[model samples]
Target: MTWLLLAGAIVSEVTATLCLRTASRPGAHKGWRVLVGAGYAAAFAFLSLALDAGMPLGVAYGIWAACGVALTAVASRVLFGEPLTRVMALGIGLIAAGVLLIELGAAH
Candidate 1:
């Protein structure tokens, strides 16, 4: 249940970030802003629920931020033709590794 809440937080955060990108574009529909706001709100709500469900803050936030970054990068590349260069991929990988270390460290 905690993992599911964390997953919701991650997905909401990523979607919000993507919507933010779209909202920044010239002549973009204003509705995107609404989605951006809602997504972020949902993300926080889910994150709080996860914490309430007994996930440690360090572990939950680490995983949420890492997954959000990775998924946002990939989704932006696919949806907007943005560059996902090798360096960026490596950076994401490093972030994932760092998050893994954080989770492991929190377990002990």
Candidate 2:
């Protein structure tokens, strides 16, 4: 199903992003370096497949970015004790709204 492909896209994107974080830290192990490279490659490969399946680029991109931002923010706050200010919440809300708008636009 298309939804499954989209889910794959989300997973790969998140993996890639998390990998980048792991890779960026100084002195990461070789395993982490391999993971990061594989993650990035898989992310692009999955996303490209999603695009090839007739999804609009804008819609796919919007969904991917929105999901990434929302999930990553919550995860970082929980895992890293990162701050979550009202301004950040507002920004995320706006991002959600924009994603909704993109979805609605696609239906017309």
Candidate 3:
């Protein structure tokens, strides 16, 4: 249950970030701003639920941040034609590895 909530938080956060990018674009519709705000609110709420369910703060946040960043970058490239440079991909890979280390450390 805690993991599920954390996953929800990650998805919400990534969606909010993408909506923010859309909202920042020239001639973007005002509705995107509303979506951005609501998505962030939902993300926080889900994160809080995960924390309440006894997930360690460091582990939860690490996973949420890493996955959110990686997913958002890929989504941006696919949806907005943004560039995914090799350097950026490498950074994302590092983030994933760090998160994995955090999770493994938390197990012991």
- The best candidate in terms of TM-score: 3
Model 3 / residue 56 / CA error / Å: 0.5
Q: Relative to the unseen true structure, what is the Cα RMSD of model 3?
A: 1.0
lDDT of 3 by residue, 43-76 (tens): 9999999999999999988898889989999999
lDDT of 2 by residue, 1-108 (tens): 555677687777777677667677789776877887787677677777888888888888889879888777776677668888899889889988998999899999
The TM-score of candidate 2 is 0.86
List runs of model 3 lying over 4 Å from the truth: none
lDDT of 1: 0.94
lDDT of 1 by residue, 1-108 (tens): 999999999999999999999999999999999999999999999999999999999899889988898999999899999999999999998998998899889889
* Candidate 1: residue pairs that collide: none
